[model samples]
Target: MTDPTPGRALPLEGVLVVACEQAVAAPLATRHLADLGARVIKVERTGRGDFARDYDTVVHGLSSHFVWLNRSKESVSADLKDPDQLARVRDLIAGADVFVQNFAPGAAERLGLGADDLRRDHPGLIHCSISGYGSTGPYRDAKAYDLLIQAEAGLVSVTGTEDHPAKAGIPAADIGAGMYAFSGILAALYDRERTGEGTTFEVSLFDALSEWMGFPLQYAAGSGHAPVRAGTSHPAIAPYGAFAAGDGVEVVFGIQNEREWERFCEVVLDDPGVATDERFASGSARVENRPALHGAIDAVLAGLTGDELVERLERAGVANARRRTLDEVLTHPQHEQRGRFVEVDSSAGPVRTLLPPITFDDGRTPRMGPIPDVGPGV
Candidate 1:
């Protein structure tokens, strides 16, 4: 019998993608494609498959990262080094609208599946190449992981507490590169419909993250100095970031302009005179006296429980939030109210997850189906 509630399909139906890939960058790009209704065939090495499969066994014996990124893909094992297998891979591309890969530099060319090689014949194909650095650069061949790129991109230097610089908890560089690849492929597909000519696209983690560094780059350019690492705190803004509340729950808030500062003094802190204090009069002044200002705000906030204080901040028009643990976030009321949970099949079993951030007019949310094993019929 059918369940009481039927499942919704993702948005990319009818599109076919042959992803000759591995790791987070490629799989993340293809997973989104699958989410949007594309038929994504993940081509893995014949024996071992994506190395990520062995990244962990936390999720009932599957890598949580792989599970998160590889859902809904159809696993297809084919050795690119094997001539017959490579021919089969090409056959897949011949029938597919898009081909994606993050193979090492010159690796794709050796296999005769490089973007240039594919474009010569499959003029209508949208070929996307994802890489660590880029096709051509001094660091083109330099190895890149999320942490390494963070340092190379100068992200790590400006992240974390002043005592220690740390990498991002997530693979932001990889995700950024994958997103660019996905969009490039989409734009290429759109272009082929008009010009009937295939286009090759390339995304480098360095460039991808460089775009993300725009703000800090501009900041440094204008100030003639890079921002100092502040951990979870906003580098420029004062009285922002986390602070402990009375109930032992931490709440976060920031003071912006004189208006907000005055309001903060009059309302939440209930010390109207503090706004006129020379130290707290302006944003820069407050930043200059951050330790004292933060101490004052912390003292006031610590007198109230997490919820009560959040209410106070909300009433005063200050942005505030309850620090939520991962477990708490999974059942957050806003997501539940918006009906974001979705069920998808997996090799291990069925699993549920949240929908993408984007919403559409058709009242349909993108679906993440099942997680596929590294090898077919495994």
Candidate 2:
């Protein structure tokens, strides 16, 4: 691995990560590591590499999913079924500071790349295994795609409208597992520094998403009922969610407290007495009579343009935002003002991408390396 320039080193500058990854979860984890300056060597199949590379051709003939997840990483093509290729991968892992894999259940062991076997030989290696259900459990070998995991973890049950439950627009389960794996690997690295020994860990999409469903799960457990699936609206809050103006522009806002609620009625609704109405007096009362409350708000808002509604909300100190489309979000003023967007070289060409969410106080930027084409085995 090349050394980072002096006095501008990233957090994981010297770390070497060898990842046998595909699809979203493992790629995302390694990509984050690569962003922080880890030397990530991604192992892929000899021919097509990652299947996600064929998910779509929206980004200059490259898959949007692949481009979004894989940056600042090196790719190596290998047929793991071949003994020589498998041996080379094992050798690479033997020298790596961290080894990450998301192989199907028992696949790693079959290839002699299992955490137990590798860690036995290299105690200083951080071994992380990301899977669908986990190494154990009845669902261990079950096919665990993003939607499947979302359904199994009850995310779909709580998402979308009451009439039609929906998976999240994004791959929530895959992202959750990827982030957890990334963090778990970071923690293990730190632990190694303190104890002089590396660690073994596992992160499953099911567990990650189940942890994410903590609030709804606890709510159901304590209240003896699941929260209602209100599309883009809160089940327990009234006057929350999207509202259309006279010009048909959508605005989303939420009233978090009685003060805000009162202000919303007086300034935005232009009716102070509405705040004291029996159906809307208390939070619970408003939620209980949400339909009537929405009707009241809609009646007042129907006459106002989107700009007028936004102005009133601002005057009332009500937290609000436009229900922006994906294209609008790409040109959002916040991102533009913050200089979040950047260009990176890819196999297709220079592609536009947002900087990683993390910002260093010292002004050291994360690595923005090229997206590699699948190359011969390392």
Name the runs in model 2 displaced over 4 angstroms.
1-6
Q: Model 2: per-residue lDDT, tens digit, 1-378?
A: 223456778999889999999999999999999999999999999989999999999999999999988888989989998998889999999889999999998999998998789999999999999999999989999999999999999999999998999999999999999999999999999999999898999999999999999999999999999999999889888888999998899999999999999999999999999999998999999989999999999998899999999999999999999999999999999999999998889868899998899887777788989888886875
* lDDT per residue as tens, model 1, 1-378: 012123555545678999988888888888878777788999998777889988999877788888888887889898676788889889889888899999998899999998778878887888888999989989989998888998899888778888898888899899999888888878887888799888888898889988999999999999999887876678788878888888899887877767887888888988899888899788888888989988888888778888888787888899888788999899999988988877777767766776766666766656556787766521
- Please give the range of 10 consecutive residues that has the lowest summed lDDT in model 2: 1-10
Query: What TM value does model 1 have?
Result: 0.94
Query: TM-score for all predictions?
Result: 0.94, 0.98
Q: Which candidate is the best by TM-score?
A: 2
Alpha-carbon local distance difference test for all models: 0.82, 0.93
